[model samples]
Target: MEKAGSPLEQVRSSIAQACKRARREPGDITLVAVSKRHTAATIEPLLIEGHRHFGENRVQEAAEKWPALREAHPAVQLHLVGQLQSNKAEEAAALFDVIHSLDRPSLVKALAKAFDKTGRRVPCFVQVDVGDEPQKGGCPVSDLPALLTQARESDIPLAGLMCLPPAEIEPAPFFAFLDKLARDHGLEGRSMGMSGDYETAIMLGATHVRVGTALFGERPS
Candidate 1:
């Protein structure tokens, strides 16, 4: 790995280069720094550097961590980028500014109720099981249409689609497929890509990339 400037700067430069090749403006892509397991101290530098978008995996962790952080950085936009339980709907709705794992009818209904109770409609990207991986938390491609309808009918503001491709394989095809899905659904936000293949994702029409390691370095195991 090359040591030059801050990790944040390196990631920004990489994103700009990717956008250049894709003929898209860097401003068009939202870089969601995944801060699931990171501490407030770890995240503060990025916040100080004017990075407003950050993603957390669990509602409880975000609730515990972000209140104080958001109090300081009022402009911060928090994104929930992990599997959300139906039971935690209201809390998740109130906490996250954006949701990237709305993948099923139950979650849709729960979020709808949550939105109604809280009167805050957070935009959500329906997670699609693009790789058909059983272990992943996403709506199967066959069930996506119905789930989408349910979400819309429940009044959940659809941001677009999100996915995690099968690991250790060429991800371009999966990213391209997600872009096609977004196009077919007439949605503009394609939340695909991560630390490893975000460049390919940009080329394939990723409007949002959930990157962790590239920005914050590896989380301690």
Candidate 2:
């Protein structure tokens, strides 16, 4: 196995390689450090290294973590990258800069209501079921057009699309498909891929890559 470098070094190298392969500038992509299951202690160094964006899976955990983190790093941006329950919509709306797993209409409606009450337009990314994994929560590809239509017609400000590729397949094709979908719909962002496959994501036009283990090391079991 290849040895991993320091988190910031790894990110810099990966961004360089991805940009080279993609024929795009490294600055075009945003690296959203996935801090799920990681303590603030583990995240501090990366923030100090100028990583401004972090993604978390659980709202409760993030709500507990971010306030202190914000005091330390006032410019940091937080993203919610897991399945969001409707009951937690308000908390999520208040905490996340972007919600990357808006799969169903009910959640969209819940988010809209939350935004209405708070008077904040929480940007969202529609998750596409590209792999059609039964275990994943996302809108089926066939339904994406209609979903995009609905999202566009609302006040929610649909930012773009996100997806999790099948574990066995190369992620490039799926990432490209998502890029195409976004272009077809006039969406401006694409959030896909993770630590294992983020290079392919960047090569295929992923505006945001959720990097966890590659940056913070594996989650403690």
Candidate 3:
């Protein structure tokens, strides 16, 4: 098993290799280090290694973990990748550079209110439920156009689309679907892919990939 330092090295190597395989410049794809289940101590080395983008999957946990780290590493760009609750929208808006899970209008309204209160336009990605999983929280692909329109009418800067593929299907098609959706909607960033299928994601034109275990090893239970 790789130690934390080696894991970071390996992740950098993988990013380089993936970019090369995709015939994209190494800088084309941004690496969002998924920092949930990781303490700031474990993340510090990566910050030293010049990794600036970090992603968290929960509002409460990330709200607790990021403050001091943000103070020490002010250049770090934090992203919220989990299911965001309306009640937590203000706190999330204040912290995250990008919110990657806008699945509902209520959450969008709350984020808009937060942005209004803070006077900051928070960039966001609408989550599309490509698989239609009942347990998941995302606007259906059919509902996406309306949602994107709603976002455009709101104060939130609609940046892109995000999705989690059905557990059984290959992620490539789902990612390609997102890429096409973004192009159709005139959006820019596509935040798809993760530790398991990020290479496929790159091939499908993922602008940002959220990688956790592949970079940090298994989460400590």
Clashes of each: 0, 0, 0
Kindly provide the TM-score of model 2 when superposed on the true structure, using C-alpha atoms.
0.94
lDDT (tens digit, per residue) of candidate 1 on 23-86: 9999999999999889999999998888899999999999999999999999999999999999
lDDT of 2 by residue, 1-221 (tens): 22346776777688888799878998878889999989999998888777789999999999998999999889998999999999999989888888999888788788888998888888899999998884788899998887777776667878799999999888888999999999998988999979888888888888999999988888988
Answer with 1 or 2, whichever has the higher lDDT. Answer: 1
> On a 0 to 100 scale, what is the lDDT of residue 168 in model 3?
70
Please tell me which predicted candidate would have the highest lDDT against the true structure. Answer: 1
Model 1 has an lDDT value of 0.94
Q: Rank the candidates by TM-score, best first.
A: 1, 2, 3
Cα lDDT listed for each candidate: 0.94, 0.87, 0.87
Q: Write the per-residue lDDT of candidate 3 for residues 1-221, one digit (tens) a residue.
A: 33454767777677788888889876888889999999989888788777899999998898899899989989999999889989998888888898999988888789889999877787898999988884888889898988888888886798799989988778787898889998998988989989988888887888889999887778889
